[model samples]
Target: MAGDTPRAQPPPPDPDPGGHHPHLLFWRWRRNPLRRRTDRLHAWIALGLLLAVPAVAAAAMLAVGDTAYRHYRSAAEHEARTRDHRAAVLVHDAPRHPEPGSDEAKKARYPVEVRFPGPGGETRTGKTDVEPGLPADSTVLVWVDSAGEITDPPLTAEQIRSRTMGWAILAFLGVAVMGLAAHGITGLVLQRRNLAGWEAAWAVTAPRWCRLP
Candidate 1:
């Protein structure tokens, strides 16, 4: 026995199909004769979850944005209608103003002044820093003869840009979630393949040793 080269042993028989080795169900399913039908089902389940979560998030953001924009625009138009009798005109367009705190600053805009029409068609003027940049020819809802010019709080262009950035972040998160889901599915498939190969190798080696006299 010492001089003889040990014959390589044949592997042990595979575990009974009903035996409870961890991941045994996975092996049975993967190596089942009807692999195509079972594989399709597994593929659909993983792919469906991978797609559905991100799609739902993106749809939610779109719906919220649309509803809010519509409400804001409608309110702006309504305010314009109420000032119709006060001889107000909307500024059609304004030139882009120079950035504040720039070297080329001309006379800085003081509080915007407003004047309204009074009972005898008299006009009064008032001043405040609030001004929605109006074109030189634009007049907004105002009682020009009764009350002084009124300044409306200006909504900065920067604020609008910030709001847009927020929406983009939500969109990016949705995309990231999709990427994670895909990565997880790939990892699961790889682990199962490795496990099956290990089991196959063991099936061959274990039986050979067990059968030794």
Candidate 2:
């Protein structure tokens, strides 16, 4: 009988009777003899920051977006009122070829001389850029400001929306960064305080335990 191989042993039993993993979600808030006041404070602070960060970021984004939209809209309206389109006669033909190796050679539009009535009703001659192949005396429309100086057109609605969204996104990211920074700082401070508290507590308890036996 002793020469026969022994049967395999059974595994150890689980420490927890219910066979459930420890609950972590609100563990800091749960009542426990080992849980400290600092732990509770940390839990509350974490919860508050979790809720506050997105709320603040969203509010800042909306405020900045609205302000940017209004500012751009007002400027567009002003430009519309102060600008005009006028027909001008070309005094000469657009160059068939741009000067070799010149910056104009890379441009899609070519500058040519043109005559138009000024704001004072006097005939004025200035250079305006246009597509190539226009013959002399050809009439073309150009944007002119209140002073009759050639200028760019106003910002389109799409441009305004794009710019507004850009500013809003930047603001949202800025607020989120600040919130993260604040949370990190708070965590460092709390960690130091908790460590100090544990050290002090251990200093008091260690001597008593040492003297017991």
Q: Which candidate is the best by TM-score?
A: 2
lDDT of 1 at 133: 48
Error of 2 at 213 (Å): 11
Q: Tens-digit lDDT track for model 2 on 103-192?
A: 665566788889988899888788899867679999988888898888788889999999999999999999989877877787678767
The 10-residue segment with the lowest total lDDT in model 2? 8-17
Error of 2 at 139 (Å): 4.5
Candidate 1: tens digits of C-alpha lDDT, residues 1-213: 433334343323334434477765454355555344334455566566668756766775666555545555565455454333354433234333467545443444434444456555675554433233455445645432113334343333454445655665576576667666765776467456655765676667656656646
Question: How accurate locally, in lDDT, is each candidate?
Answer: 0.50, 0.79
RMSD of each: 12.8, 12.0
Clashing pairs in 2: none
